[model samples]
Target chain A: DQQVKQNSPSLSVQEGRISILNCDYTNSMFDYFLWYKKYPAEGPTFLISISSIKDKNEDGRFTVFLNKSAKHLSLHIVPSQPGDSAVYFCAASARGAGKSTFGDGTTLTVKP
Target chain B: DTAVSQTPKYLVTQMGNDKSIKCEQNLGHDTMYWYKQDSKKFLKIMFSYNNKELIINETVPNRFSPKSPDKAHLNLHINSLELGDSAVYFCASSQPDRDGGYTFGSGTRLTVV
Candidate 1:
């Protein structure tokens, strides 16, 4: 069974607009959530992360909002660019679990 | 320079053949892990090692084995490769302090026919 779920397989958005990706989890033990952006033929690179203690974390153009009570998290990218057209994966982990559980991934295409 | 590097980026072998993928990390991280991404693009953890010690071993097949020679190196060896073994195998490293921010290799695409 998948502990982390990204129901959306793909999303399209216009450049300079907002793009939101959603993820849900079944495990309450997961306290840390992370997002990674992956290009074809390459490994995933860290995008953003949020801790259960905090509801939101932002870095420049990327922001991650966590709803602990809902066991859900969403990643928001404002003014999305064509370079942002890549697969995004949501992952969750707990302390000492070391390993993370990753969703199937969401492909976001930022149209130009 | 790539922090996590895996050699032989692509491998194509016949079924029942044995193949091995090597991975190394330059960062002085204490933990390393192996993850598999299937055709469906689902990423799953296979194994994890810390200081050359086996830490987390997922519900993987016995044909797959992970060996860590040093803290910076982890290798995956698969025997009797099956058709379903065709997938992208990723090697990753994470510092214990960063929670779970992992540095991943470019990934080795293995195709078993």
Candidate 2:
């Protein structure tokens, strides 16, 4: 079973526009959520994360919003750039689980 | 220096051959994990080790074995590989607390023909 789900396989947005990626999870035991960006032939890098206690976390142009009640989370990149084009993966882990569950990933293309 | 590194970035071998993938982490983290990204782009956990002790072992085939000689090294050995064994395997490390996200290696793509 896929505990984490990124329903959108791909997304496209114009440069300098807003890019939003969505993810949902079926496991309520997950308490921490994270986002990772991956490029071709490279491993995923950490982007942003939010705990179940908080609703939002922001870093520079990237922001993550977590809606615990809906079991949904989203990543928002303001003024998207061409360099932002990559696969974004949503991951979640229960406290002390020692491992995280990852989504299938959503490929984002920011057109310049 | 790379935080997590895996050897043999690409491997192409015939079916029934045995191969080994080596992984090392310089981050000094206590926990390390192996993740396999399949054709569908799903990253699934294969095994996990904490301080050279096995912690999590998913429903993987018995042919696949993970050996952790030390906290910094975790290696995967596959015996009699099948065509379905082809995938990109990633090694990652993180602190036991897990407050921060994991650091992953570039990944090793294995193709069994």
Candidate 3:
């Protein structure tokens, strides 16, 4: 069973526009959520994360919103750039579980 | 220096052959994990080790074995590989609490013909 799901397989957006990626989870025990960006032939890199206690967290141009009631989270990149094009993975982990469950990933392409 | 590194970035071997992927981390993390990214692009956790002791073993095949000689090193050995076993395997390290996300290796892509 896929505990975490990224329904969108791919997304495209124009440069300098807003890019939003969505993810949903079924396991209510997951208290921490993370986003990772991966490029071709490279491992995924940590992007942003939010705790279930908070509704939103922001870092520079990137922001993450968590709706605990809906079991959904989203990543928003304002004024997206071409360099932002990559596969974004949504991961969720229960506290003290020591392991995270990852989604299938959504490929985002920022067109210049 | 790379925090987490895996050897043999690409491997192509015939079916039924045994292969191993070596992983090492210089970050001094206490916990390490192995993840498999299959053709469908799903990253599944295969195993996890904490301080050279096994902590988590997912529903992976028995042919897949993980060995951790030390907290900084975790290796994966697959015996009698099958065609469906081809995938990109990633090794990652993190603190025992995992409050911060994991640091991942570049990944090793294995193709079994």
Chain B TM, per prediction:
0.96, 0.99, 0.98
Clashing pairs in 2: none
- Candidate 2's C-alpha runs over 4 A off are none
Q: Supply DockQ values for each candidate.
A: 0.76, 0.87, 0.83
Could you give the interface RMSD of candidate 2 in angstroms? 0.6
In the order shown, the chain A TM-scores of the predictions are 0.99, 0.99, 0.99
Candidate 3 residue spans exceeding 4 A from truth: none
**Cα misplacement distance, residue B49 of candidate 1 (Å):** 0.3
Q: Per-residue lDDT of B1-113 in model 3, one digit per residue for the tens?
A: 99999988999999999999999999989999999999999999999999999999999999999999999999999999999999999999999666669999999999999
lDDT of 1 by residue, B4-90 (tens): 999889999999999999999998999999999999999999999989999999999999999999999999999999999999999
B48 Cα displacement, candidate 3 (Å): 0.2
Provide the global lDDT of candidate 2 against the true structure: 0.96
Worst 10 residues of 2 chain A by lDDT: A44-53
Supply candidate 3's per-residue lDDT for A49: 86
Clashing pairs in 3: none
Tell how far residue B112 is off in model 3, in angstroms.
Answer: 0.3
DockQ agreement of candidate 1 with the native complex? 0.76
